[model samples]
Target: MNKNISAGWRDFHASAKVYYLWLALGWVEIRQRYSRSKIGPFWLTISMGILIAALGVVYGTLFKADLKSYLPLLAVGFVFWAFISTTISEGCNAFIAGSAYIRQMPLSRGIFVFQTIWRNIVILGHNFIIVIAVLAIFKINFLPGLAWFVLGFLLLVVNLFWMSALLAVVCARFRDLPQIITSALQVVFYITPILFKRDMLSKYPLLIDLNPFAHMIEIVRGPLLGEPVPAVSWLACTAMAVVGILICLAFHGRYRSRIPYWV
Candidate 1:
């Protein structure tokens, strides 16, 4: 067990040594995705802008919230949520999706995970432009909390690394898991306080308080929306990152070598 754990940690670190290779690969993926398209990746920004505008108006009116305030929140929330949700849900297929590379060459499995996160980071950059526009239109002062937003984003990336590691291994072994993860994420989306404020469920704070996704979203969305940093979210996410890393270390140590076979 100890040797396996050590090996897993070593493999994870070794993969980071080739960060540039995978990062470039990630960009290649984005470029290929829009190879012939004129607007390229900005289509993500345009689509997100449309969603935010349409949903913000409809949900704001339905919930009796002000558009000036709610639109910025929705825009930031959706951008972050899209990144988070896509990273996690797609992470299940990380190893399986890279089956060709895993079998044809001797490469670090961690590269695939990093590629997934990096690809989403690129997409997030595109989507975040919409959030900036919404904030500007609403006159929200996001510059004041820029430091916290960066910190939160870094922490979120840490969380995603561990998450992708674990899911990559598990989903490779269990073929049906990708579908299950998709369904579960869909359920989590409705429960998370993205479209609706947590205050609406004031009577049952646990709904949001106990949800890691809510905290994940809050840490990033809070600062962008000019809201105070939720200390509870910071602490919760930090703890989860630590725990997730430990779990990934153990899981990968025991199963990392078998990933290619499974795929």
Candidate 2:
């Protein structure tokens, strides 16, 4: 067990040392994905802008929300949620998709997971243009709390890294897991406060308060929406990251060697 743990820790350390390799690979993926397109990834930004507009108009009316405030809220929440969801979904196939490299070279498997995450982050950056435009158009000035967004985004990324690492290993073993995760995320989307404000569910406060994703969204979204950082959310997300990382290390360590066989 200790040996497995040590191996797992070393895998992560080695992968971190070669950060340049994964960073470059991630960028290569983005370029390759839109190689022939003129606008490239900006196509994502355009699509996201349209979706945010449609959702903002439809749901805003459904909830009787003001367009100025509602549009900005929807834009930021959706963009971040897309990052979170796609990372996890793609993370499932991190090892499976990289089977060629895994078989050919003795590379750290964690690199694939990081690549999956970094790719989605790049896409998130594209989608975030919509968020910026919405914020500018709505004149939502949360510049004073912008520092909190940096901290929150870091915490969010850390949590996501552990999650992706763990999922990559498990899903390599169980091919069906990715489909299950995809279906689960659809449900999570509705339950999470992306499309609606948490306060809207005032009667059942635990639904939002107890949900880890809700806390994750709150730490980042709250800051941009001009709301004070929720102390509870910061604590919740920090605790989850610490615990999840430890769990991922142990699991990945024990199963790290077996991944090649599984993939």
Query: Candidate 1, residues 211-247: lDDT per residue as tens digits?
Result: 9999999999999888986789999999999888888
Flag regions of model 2 displaced more than 4 Å: 1-3
TM-score, cand. 1:
0.97
Model 2 poorest ten-residue lDDT run:
1-10
Cα lDDT, all candidates: 0.89, 0.89
Q: List the candidates' TM-scores in order.
A: 0.97, 0.97
Clashes of each: 0, 0
